[model samples]
Target: MADEKERRHQHFLVVAYGAQSHVNPARVLAHRLARLGGADDGSILATLSVAVAAYCNMFPSLDATTDGVISYVPYSDGVDDVSLPRDIADRARRRRASSESLSGIVASFADRGQPVTCIMCTMVSPPVLDVAREHNIPLAIYWIQPATLLAIAYHYFHGYNELITSHANDPEYEVCLPGLTRPLQIRNFPSFFIDVSGTERAKAFIEVFQELFEYMDLWRPKVLVNTFEELEPNVLAEMKQHLDVFTVGPMVRSPMETQIHLFTHDNIDKESYMEWLRAHPDESVVYVSFGSLVKFSKHQIDEIVGGLRQCGRPYLLVLRRDGIEDDQSHSLVENTQSQGMVVDWCDQLEVLSHSAVGCFVSHCGWNSTIESVVSGVPIIGVPLMFDQPTNIYLAEKEWEVGIKVERNSDGVLTGKELARCIELVMGEGAEAKVIRERANVLKEIVQATSDTGGSAERSLRDFVKTIQES
Candidate 1:
């Protein structure tokens, strides 16, 4: 068995971005790749994962979670704990160390009989790609963002900078970009593109995307995006013109497979939450989460409390500390008298799968978006930053799975407005019915695309074939 394995694909390394959001998808993809090694074909691929130290500390489960499918490795990035103060200097050190550590990984793997053949790095780790190129190891990028964001990045770096920038201030102003069917409002554009001079981190993401584009220009490599073909056909088609793009995702667990989580479950009566849903009528509860980041302001938290009270719905909200000083949201959650429960975190996918979950109040993170889509839950988008706005646009404008609530003149989403949006989605109205039906339809489509021998599976097979050929 060892000799046969040695004769085949040998090894494929998946480097994770370490954050819960990034690592979760990367690990799922790695699992698929590992499983592919056992296919009837006379090929084998040993999968290994490398995560940055910072997220490693946050999610120690990665160290013990693999069930002999993939090997987990950690690379130090100056600050092992993300809670530590990090700046440009720390980032530079992390990048340099990551590259060197990868070099060591390559040598170590080569020393073993199974040599590393390909490296698939999750988004935000260009240094991993550089190491792969330097080592002459074939590599692909696993883009976790939606194809719409990819299109936005492509156009932003290509030529549409002036048009996008001009409308940055006009939150209601809409702009048409290539590949997308609907016009994107200024509010729909990613905050970084609108606020180019916004923050150091935002600027850093621009630089990263710019560098990634440059690398792609140098070598138009394959990019494995975390979306199915049906979800974003136009954007995927247009992106394919530039590089070999494959839709190898909705890289998520099936409903039959137990839900995957990187963080510890908030020690709530986990079963009781599901039981609460079972007690409620179908499509009668609300699910809310901001996806591992973004602390809600006290004002925002208060508004949420108000909305839940006004809507008078059974709701589950994931309220984490998120390493911020602001305790108003947490405190208010503790004290608020709403007919709902708040967990620091919960089995989000499982909660979404519950028949009682009527609509999702989401931050529009890609993972949450896809999960909601798969679960057939309609959404109410409250996007904050990064790729969220674009996701909300897709949800509200493109897919019709959700609506984005309007902020007041003070730019606050008051309780009344929040209640209004929730009612709009969850109420027994024509629009709400339409959204639910569309969400259900999309859910079937997503499941079909993710089923065995489906779009996502075929894409993975093709990716494996590419590695074999290489």
Candidate 2:
């Protein structure tokens, strides 16, 4: 009872922008703080109230415990209706409503004696940063993307498009950046920013990237990235020179690390998937998943199906409908006829860690990339957009641990190429054995990071100290 009373008196506030990547970590931190019981009025303001509410509904056990200490403030209502590609534009359009909600939440927190001390802004949500500044609080931005991607974004802001453009034409062009000695080209850079589509809306969106880079320069907030130093040593070192960086990542260590209460259905058959994998000989099953957000067209989906079919090895696929535009194409699963068990979603960590799973075919989302690395699984990289290409580049080029697939005009990966790509990773291709060995080494390092005295533990401790000191 005395402990509860003491916990009730200590407080801290975290504002997460409307994304699961941001909310998950914030939720974990909130729970960690609550378990410590330092303050009662600690508030967690989130932009994804609907998502969080849905998560709470799905996983009551985890969320219900800390509800008393953490307050979820929905900064924008109905924001999920907006398409992800146009998220910033939508936020800009509703700036007034957004600002009002944010200010109100901070003011409310103040009224309760829980002065907002630290705000963790995700991606380019400047409003959260603005509110933190208004309240005189220390703000830290978390990047789910690799540092190399951030550097590319910075390059784009500075009008250095030559490296990206040149690289796309010739993968060996070796375009140079401030910190990198080797010239990188377009084939390796993020494909999304290649050509401005000349739409007014697109042009407006382009400005946001520049605005984000400029904002970072002006604010210079300490950054805590969900990436590991070992994965992108060059990029991490360069980024650290610019601002304070702490690389304690692969945040999705497991279901427990996610901190959100997920429904059992969301993870059901996870063990079954592992059991199936174990039945196979070692390093046989290939796991395929295109991270959470990317959508694909029908032609591309057909190609992907063809490629997987060609592999002829047991495979586990996490399928989503976002990729196929046509209803028919979206039904590729029906035609594939269960050659590979196509699930909508599963516990990724369990599947990757399964003994039967040998390789990962991924969109190279940082979370997925790191998870695959930690699991000692090599990757077949098919990056889609944003930081994905950069993530793929680091996985393949920097780490020498993956194979890249070529994308067609419509950004569809054909079945033939997909099959070949899988074989290249699994077969005795060039550098295949060497890459596998390196991947195993990386896996060990990631395990150590999560263990005692590793970078992740140290970073989390530093995070706690920042809050306590503040």
Sum up the clashes in candidate 2.
17
Candidate 2, which segments miss by more than 4 Å at Cα?
1-13, 17-73, 77-80, 83-91, 158-174, 255-275, 335-338, 408-411, 428-430, 463-470
Model 1 poorest 10 in a row by lDDT:
77-86
Candidate 2 per-residue lDDT over residues 4-108, each given as its tens digit: 644334344555644444566556445544544435343322222223344444345534323554555455533433344355556565655555667777787
Using Cα atoms with residue i matched to residue i, what is each candidate's TM-score against the true structure?
Answer: 0.92, 0.82
TM-score of 1: 0.92
Best by TM-score: 1
Candidate 1 structure quality by residue, lDDT tens digits, 84-171: 3266777787788778877887887788755888887877576787688789988788889988888888888899888888777888
lDDT of 1: 0.78
lDDT of 1 at 410: 80
Clash number for every model? 0, 17
